[model samples]
Target: MRRSPWSTLVVLAIAQFMVVLDVTIVNVALPRMQTDLGFAPDDLQWVISAYTLIFGGFLLLGGRSADLVGRRRIFVAGLVVFALSSLAAGVATSPLELILFRGVQGLGGAMLSASALTLLMVTFEHGRRRTIALGVWGGLAGLGGTMGAIVGGVLVDNLSWRWVFLVNVPIGIVVIAATFFIIRESRAIISGRRTFDVAGAVLSTTGLLAIMLGVIRAEPLGWGSIEVIGLLAGGVLLLAAFVLVESRSAAPLIPLRLFRTRSLSLSVVALGLNSAGFLAMFFLTAIFLQQVRGLSAFDTGLAFLPMGIAAIVGAVVASRFVTMFGTRAVQVVAAVISVIGLLLLSTADASSPYASSLLPGLILFGLGITAMGVPAQVAAQSKVRTDDAGAASGVLNAGYQVGGALGLAVITTLATAHITDAMTGGTAPLAAAVGGFQFGLLIAAIFAAVNIVIALLSPSVTVDSATATEAAELEPVAI
Candidate 1:
């Protein structure tokens, strides 16, 4: 049953990369998908949201499933489901069909993502091996932004958007086969008789769906709209109810007690804020590059390659710095560095050069993100029972999804309002609308700075993996 740690890392990273890459690959293809599928501008959001919302909403359940069933089995099952769904999506003739298939793909993606980390944890023994693995996993998440831009442009421009989905087919087959051969499976041990938390799952999932839907609709419908208000309210109430139910449930899908760790609580908050800034920054910058700088799609993708490479390099360095610099110090310093990057990004104008103005911020942001995210991820999963890796992973992923959703809403609203105000008296072209996006980058920088403040105040942060619990000591992969 033994497998080389390297084999396990490679398999898990591929799966994780696919899951994360999907988050952005569709960005460049939105226009083509709409034209071919007849999806309206508004409806196109679902192409992205459908995948993320389901993936985020069901992540907790998926994590728990991995523990109860088996990590390796669920992992492979997820890939099969994902691959089939991708094929369905690639060939879909209608928006509705594509959306449905996208949701299915998200479900499988959630399951695969939920198990991948736990397997990585169990595959590599605690100590240096785990750290390197974690660095790889964490690094890949950051690299997704750059890769998505490049791959999306190539596929959309040269071939077709469908390649984004079809490309997954071969990759999925290879990863699934390699995983089966290289990964060891683990199952959760239950005490006496335990029941699944059906009520808790229903409440939380519905609650999250409501909140996510409402948040995403804020810009289109206006936050003041009754429908948006109602959904948000209902989401908050259902989440509250879920918490109450979890308190009394015999076996909660999400262990409420995990929040007892000071480090875990702080890390999640930091992760969310950091993600908010990170996601919004890219959306804003891409618009700036294309609309403002007049860069071609291919050029935009090329512009991002450096940031991607820097992320991997920075993450490996950050992981090593954990023990020497101390996790908390690195976190605070990293947040500050990202803030500086965000600050630099805010200065970018139509006349600024990419190499000088943008590169500095991108590099700083890359380094800071790698440092903060990797450590926080390691910290969040460090104390939980190995069986709860899925839950732990889901929690971190939730922060990521929540942050992105919240950021998208906040930035879109702010940017639109500013742009609309400036052009209210005149009929401005699409360029004026794009100007609004630049201000969104400024707002995103503000959010990044907020994360820095949060990191600065969290004196409880520690990076020594030993400080994390025995079962939770598995290293993070930069993937």
Candidate 2:
């Protein structure tokens, strides 16, 4: 199959958007889901965590599968799974059923998202075209969370919470049908010498799941609690075992040599740190708006609309910035901007007006994140070999998912402890919540500042007109 590059991008971007949107779409609808399904308060968290854990755990395996089998095949398979699971979730009669379906949705998302990026990489050459494509891709990635909230709100308000899941069914079907005609298949040239590293995959996936479990549970259980400590320790040991297994495997799930590329490694680190701060910002701000500012779900979603718009604008401009200033410089500037935004947000309180205090910070953070995210992705993918494209993409995405999980856990814990202290000191509930959110914002600012340092340390890599034209001339893969 052959298709116009733009059409191919549209297909892939839509798929990516659907997968990413699910991450946060259910958040606003949680209370409704709980009431309908009779969920216990503690068990409600699983509705979100189930998707996240499975997505994070299987990302590497999904990426590697794309490399070994085929991108188009994995992408289509993922769509089928995602759509079916989404349908199941929509009609779920019990909390356990919804959670299980959501886990399946996450698994499908991992396969789809991992291959989607790899497909984009293969379809576009590594220069201007790729940069522009990635900017769009990264912009969508940034927009997904905000959009999810918005879409979830409208659906939940106008129809029902189940609409959020049902919506994916139609979109998935359209995408799957279009994909077969529009996208071509591509995979690494397999060799008989290579074998699947089942042991490595098992260890890495289980290790990551355990780590995320520990992190998520830490919010409910104290960080110093025995269960938390044990889960964390076990996770670390399993990951270590994964590394050892990969070192000895004939076909490792992730090539350790990929990390030897300083740009890729540093970019991955920056991506993780950036995601940690960015996602924590979203988590805290959403809570602040609803719990403290007394905004309804619909209003809260509207509040974030500007952030989504700003992110799209920033993403559109990022390619040009990368062309002119290089990835390292853009990353540094973006980090600085994000830090300022976080700091601005830290000053917000119960009395702060939305326009004066909240909006400005949201805009700045949105702009900074899109600018940083696109270029960081480009930098990481720039030097990777075609054979390792899926694996590399998986590693990058894993950094994002894991970082968000870990960051949310740590920041939430810190904020909760602060809230506890304030309450013990006789602070009002709402005031304490606001104070705790402010503290979390401050910590998030620190994280962004660290990203600035990391970005500054990264080696410079720029795109020029010559490279752009050269890349455009290269032939895309054909099935």
Candidate 3:
């Protein structure tokens, strides 16, 4: 069943937008949620960490399930789970209840996100059309991250913090309905003896969960804590077991052979590194805006708007350049731009105005990250077979999720340590905080700089062969 590719993209993008939006939307609402739910100061982190850990942990399973079950089926099921969980979260009377619901929401998010990307890949044939569609997808994703703060602020200020979760209800319903009509059900066509790798799934899921748990707790517990060390070691051991299982299984959960694809392998590596820095940048920036600058939630969110706009523009520019030049060149250049952005950001201080110090760096970083991201995404998906779309998508998304969790954990610790030392050395509170942020941004800059080498390792591929004829031959979609 052939559906209009653009229409398919719209539905998929909307679903993915919700997934990404939830990652940061609650950030601005944390204060209100803490007050209303009577959450302890330390426990508040669970509100965010729960969602991230579950989402990151089960992504591989959710993605592979889409292939074994059905992409459209999993997508619709995810929406149902996500919507119900959102409603539950909105009305929760206690912190524990809200945290549990958020974890469920993350599970649904993993299901939707992986399948949506898979369906998009199968719907749009690999060519200029797919690249353009991916560009749009990447732009909307970046927009969602930026818009989360804005939307969360407005909802929290005008309505209530509950609206942050409640907002997804109507949007989820509409998208769920639209998805059935727009997306055709698709799944991997297995040859024979369809065997599910149960051991692989269990090991990988538990392993990821353990690692994410360790990372999330590291900030409060300290990285040197016995619990953190145990969790990290256990996760590594489980993942090692998973690798062994995959190598022996006839129908592996994640085919070890897929990593043999240079483009996909390199793309995932670069993305993981890029995401580490990107998430750290946002985390630090938000803290600086709210803590040091003493901006209201709404005002802090507004400060991020320019970066979002720059991200959209970057996606468009990257798509064009990939068509004209190639993936490797665009990725290399984008990495360089991101490094410059981070460097600029490091220069900001307590007295520095937003317009003069922060805005330029935000815009440049946003543009560079999104631009580099689109090509890497396209290249990764392009190199994989249709049967492995869900697996590949899952791996890609997991890289991003885990990278963010790990990055925020390490980066925030470094920043906090710096601030603690500065204060001990007789630095003022404001100056110490400012110095901490600068140091964090510098570390993030180093992460971005590493991407240049990673990008250089990409296989050069151009989408120009069908550019002229394909553009002329494309049909206009009312959607």
Candidate 4:
């Protein structure tokens, strides 16, 4: 008997991991980037936000474009563009140049990310094949954040920040070559739509940028400032308009009907927290370990091993767990577990010992995070037609990316505010910074608790795949 025609999972997983790892790898390099480029403390968020904003903003369009054009072609194109952008970013001499190149890199990431999973889904037929492939895929998601930090620390400590971006150069080339050789072109289920949803895309992306900027800037600008208030209002209005436009359009960027699924809807909200807590923790922990606790990049990265290993093991474990007690139950428990970890993290301080203080929190957080991997992925893509699968997955991907962007902005702003406020009259500013980080992590824990409630709304069994269009369709079933 002939084997099913599956694309190269190894190449795809490696490519996808590169994209995900890039998200955090640069973080360990942030201090170096800031010093070399002479970036102001306040202006530094751009370095991080540059990639995420573009990635989140363009994800839907990228995903839809793959369906309209061809996944293999788009995926390869994305890799080439991403590789070039990495080179440009690595060699950048000025802060402005780095930010510009980072944005370009983000564009490529958006394109690659939007289509990678779609290709995988198409490559593997449903059932056992799909299950194994997805496990590998999900493991990448768990490992990416941790590995990025690990690699970033090693690179930044040994070579330079440039190495962080430069590392992608070779990896990208290899993935592209392998993709061409091992991957086959797959046509979109439906083709030749009259017009793309350009207007909706513009509105949605602009709105998201406004919101993220507002959140990030609220630290310096103050939440009550007109800039924050105006951006928030504008973002809300633009997003509302995006929704209205999507409803009226003949060819919508996001088929609003996808929200109809309870599982998909709730999973998105869950993923938002997952992305926020998981990714943001990496950023915050790295900064806190080095800046406040006076640890080196290598030390900070080494500290993350426990959490990283746990996330991968947990995700693999979750695949088996979800098949038994069902997704909803596993997710609810996962949320609670992660929340506990965040709560533990809130107790972290500049003077805290790695073993007595940070280790327990990271280990527990890793365990809970491990639980969320499968359910969130499954719920997000459980339903929907195979044709719309790319779009559907892109929705969750956007949520994940956008959520991380928002998390960085919101948590960073809150921490900054708390630190500034606490540093009255010559108080130790560094300690204040650590305290601020704790405050931010606490807020993240609260956010995850909301995820727990959302997960509780899911069902004890797998959702039916027929009516997966509605965003909140599967959510109601969980309750």
CA lDDT for candidate 4: 0.76
The Cα error of candidate 1 at residue 233, in Å, is: 1.1
Total clashing pairs for each candidate:
20, 0, 0, 26
Reference-based TM-score, model 2: 0.85
Per-residue lDDT tens digits for candidate 4, residues 67-112, read 7788888899889989999999999999889988988888898888
Best by TM-score: 4
lDDT score of model 2? 0.78
Can you write out model 2's per-residue Cα lDDT over 124-168, one digit (the tens) per residue?
A: 987778878876775666567668888888888889999989999
Residues 1-479, model 3: lDDT tens digits: 23688989998989888888887788778767877899854455567766865777677777677888998999999999999999999999999999999989988998887788778889888877887887677667766877898988888888999999999999999998898787899998878776767688678767876886676567567889999999999999999999999999887767898899998888777777777777778767776787788777788789888887787677667767878888889899999999999999999887788888999999998789877776787677667898676567667767766665666556666777788789899999989989999999998898889889988888877775344222211100000
Give all TM-scores, in the order shown: 0.85, 0.85, 0.84, 0.89
Clash count for candidate 2 is: 0
- By the TM-score metric, which is better: model 2 or model 3? 2
From the highest lDDT down, the ranking of the candidates is: 3, 2, 4, 1
Error of 2 at 59 (Å): 2.4
Per-residue accuracy of model 1 over 1-479 as CA lDDT, tens digit each: 34578878888888888877887677656656867889854455567656766676666777777877898998999999999999999999999999899989988988898888778877778787777777677556556655887887788778888988999999999998787678888977767655767687678767877886686667668889999999999999999999999899777766788788666777778877776676667656665676568775566667767766766666666666665766667777878888888778777777777888889888888777766776676666656678666566667776666556556656655776667666775737564655676677778778777776766665533555444322122222221
- 427: Cα error in model 1, Å: 5.7
Instruction: Predict model 1's lDDT versus the native.
Output: 0.72
**Which parts of model 3 are misplaced by more than 4 Å?**
1-11, 31-46, 92-98, 120-142, 177-187, 195-199, 212-225, 378-390, 421-429, 465-479
